[model samples]
Target: MKLLVVLVSFLAACKAQNPEPCTSPALLSGQLTLATQNEQLWAFARYLYDALGQRIRLQEMGFYQNKSFTYDALLLYREGVMYEINNQESTCKKRALRADFHPMAVPRNASLMGQAVLGSSSGPGQGVLVNTWTGHLPDNARYLVTVTEFGCIPISTSYRTQPFGWMVTSFFNNVIGISDPNQLNPPGFCQDALHEEPIDFFSLFHMMK
Candidate 1:
């Protein structure tokens, strides 16, 4: 029918009007933003890496009590350097990379806040991770730490995924507005709780080809 032919032509015209760009570049450098109006959780992650992904470094702000953390590391063959500065007082140290656990999983009894314990999540991205256990906080600490944001970009031209790299999870945070940190108990995965309060977020660094 004439109407069907017109619809096809219109669709083809729209496709020709705007096409996707070359997202798969030899190297990529971009910013990651994770924020909310209440300021309960906010962070900026900037990263730079090449096609092979042999070397990479990322700078971040607002992971803990408005603290900043940095990673001057590498990512290749499931291995690389791991350098992190928790706060101004904590000096930077080079250590072997440990991809065994999710990067967002914080150490127990972390001095920052909350003498409390943390649970693990198989979520995407290194955005914000906050799965806190409320009852037993070691000493004197502020937040129970059931909320966090992190990112892991696997950049390589040969990388099977796309855009020569991937941001598995970027600036992902799942924080619920509650009177107490313990009151915030999210689902198993951040994406599972997307419809809830204090919505969780994940950002796309570059468009995929």
Candidate 2:
């Protein structure tokens, strides 16, 4: 009985030490990093309306000069890949979420090398996303994408389950490492992902329109 207790305690301790093996997905690779690294966040934002067609249409946008935001990239650690984007426009426009927020761009096939830039000096931000397929990538062109990072401020799932909004929020909270402090309650129809608190989704949409 004593041995059994010791074994259980040991297992519990091990579990506590390693909460979860966190692995970031590779967003690009090689020379692509050069094109993307050290670039402004909003420079490459675009929106992809129809992804099913042969040639995907891309609508790009820039950031509001007044507001400063974190730049992001798509990284696949397991595959050793990364993409760099550096461009900015001056405009504040609204389009269909399908056409404005989510744009589809093509992925590069070539590879290049670079001295790994330290975290602070340059390179990807904390907006890292993991374990999620970036839907379908284009074959001929490099698709402009916006990787938005979101945090669950305080909301419970039980109370809130908006259509596509909550589904996204939940993905950020449960799978992407973003944690929520409050239970999502007052369950009702919600249209925004951030129905309750500030949940940033700028990290996921690489292509912002």
- Top lDDT hit: 1
What's the lDDT for all of these models? 0.34, 0.25
Which has the greatest TM-score? 1
lDDT of 1 by residue, 51-142 (tens): 44334445555443344444332233234334333234434443444333123233354333322223433555433332222222233222
Lowest lDDT 10-mer window, candidate 1?
Answer: 200-209
- Model 1's alpha-carbon lDDT is 0.34
Q: Tens-digit lDDT track for model 2 on 1-209?
A: 99999999999998774322121231211111111222332333221112122111222334423243333332222222222222242212212221122212212332211112223534566234211112222323222222222221111111112221211111122232213211111112222213122122333333332
What local lDDT does model 1 show for residue 23? 21
